[model samples]
Target: MPSNPTLLDDQPATGAPPSSPSATTIGDLEAGLDRLQSQGPPARRDLVRSLLPVAAVVALLCVWQILSWAGLKRSDLLPGPLTVAASLADAFADGTLQRAVATSLLRGVSGFAIAILIATPLALLLAQVRTLRAALGPLVSGLQVLPSVAWVPAAIIWFGLTDATVYFVVLMGATPSIVNGLLSGIDQIPPQYRSVGTVLGATRLQHTLLITLPAALPAYLGGLKQGWAFSWRSLMAAEIIAVGGSIGFGLGSMLQQGRDLSSMPLVMAAILAILVVGIVIELLVFSPLERRLLRRRGLLTQGAS
Candidate 1:
């Protein structure tokens, strides 16, 4: 009897019995995904979108160059962008920059992977058990607030100046944020989602796998992004503080070496390298994944910042 065609479209067709709620929800999600996929913007717009950030970075570097030239006497203390670039080039030519980047990235990736494996199951367990959540949720959140650098000394003492220490710091830094993100996602799920799954005869595992996870993905992915940031930061701290000849030289070690030699250009170069690596990971890995997810959920429009 509804006058709206859209309303009628959702209703049973020609006296057919109503579709189950779970079926209706699934169909809606699939239709939304397809619609969003077809609505993506033109390639030209995507090109422009990508160029904006590059332009901003160029402008910032120009300003840095101007400032460095303005203060000739302080140039030794505060090297210009060009000086930093030249230093970076020298490091690259000697393969020090490349080796440091490779070592740091390997540790970061491995630590983050281990954190994910540990956090996911622990998060699920905490979500299911009210008593455990009540007892441990605050502790997990508290851990996230603690600076990752603080864990460096403890890790060094417990595991020595080896790779084990770096990984321990990374795991400690990343896992809490991931756990909190999943728990928060689970909390946000509507009661009807659980009821619908139960009514459709879904087993406990089926309900979690099919319904819970997909619904919780956005927040979970956010947590994963934050977790990676923490892991990288923690790895850097451990490398700087727990340096040993046995451990491979990483970006942190390069920065520390610069400080020891009073080489401002090398210090600036190392810092720039760290920033570049983080930006590359963000753009090449997380950004695309996040955009795809947001677009699929109709929360983001193509070419929108």
Candidate 2:
């Protein structure tokens, strides 16, 4: 008989059969690698975006140094970047800068914390009680616009020329902003969310803590940030006016002393120190916090990256 074709040979070929397990796994890994490769450029772009500002700052310092070398401005008035840097180094070596920074930071942070502690509960209470809100709302809003420096006189009267006076001024400046911010956040919360909470058997406290607090956190944090700024400014103003034998040496005191001595570089140094501290705190603390909260809520955009 003629040789019979085996079943395998007799079957008409459509195409390659399904891959073996090893081949399939290899193909999957290749696809995954391709996907990752495609995603790499965007990550790099984001990194560049984050680094661009730092590069710009470095460039600015270079420009400033060049201008200083060329004597573009009076050293006494404009004070070359190098001179400022030297002054900063000197201050650090003398231990004056560290002590001043610590004193100012302590006053600002302590007062800010106290303000938040006072304002948060008050905001919650006002948010829940219509009567309390109606009674206090106008006052709180008005207080936000009042200059913190105005409180210095009253604080001095109430607490004298001690640290307590400085703390009082900071509290007055920060508390209103915090309370108003929290209240505004609460007000913006949708009634639908409250209804849903009620339907889900959430008690008043549970609803406030779990649902309302989380929902209002962004605004609350914003208020807290603003409050901190106000507290810092207020504390500085208070220190400038109230510094005496009893009050510790602070950045504001340094500025005052520089003015007394007519040392422009020292005055500028104190101002620069204040500015740097504010920026560092905002960048290291509040900015990250805001970014994290906003990202979790999907409110932050790619541009924000």
Best by TM-score: 1
Q: Each model's TM-score, in the order given? A: 0.84, 0.82
Write candidate 1's Cα lDDT for 1-305 as tens digits: 34435556668576654444456666987998999888455333466667888999999999999988999668889899988989999999999999999999999999999999999999999999999999999999999999988988887777777888888999999999999999899999889999999999999999989999888998999999999999988888888887884678999999999989999999999988898999999989998898889877877754474
Candidate 2 TM-score to native: 0.82
Model 2 C-alpha lDDT per residue in residues 159-207, reported as the tens digit of each score: 7889988888899899999998898888888889989999999998899
Question: What C-alpha lDDT, on a 0 to 100 scale, does residue 269 get in candidate 2?
Answer: 86
> Which stretches of model 2 miss by more than 4 angstroms?
1-45, 66-73
Q: Which residue pairs come into collision in candidate 1?
A: none
Q: TM-score for model 1?
A: 0.84
Error of 1 at 300 (Å): 1.6
Angstrom error of the Cα, residue 4, model 1: value is 18
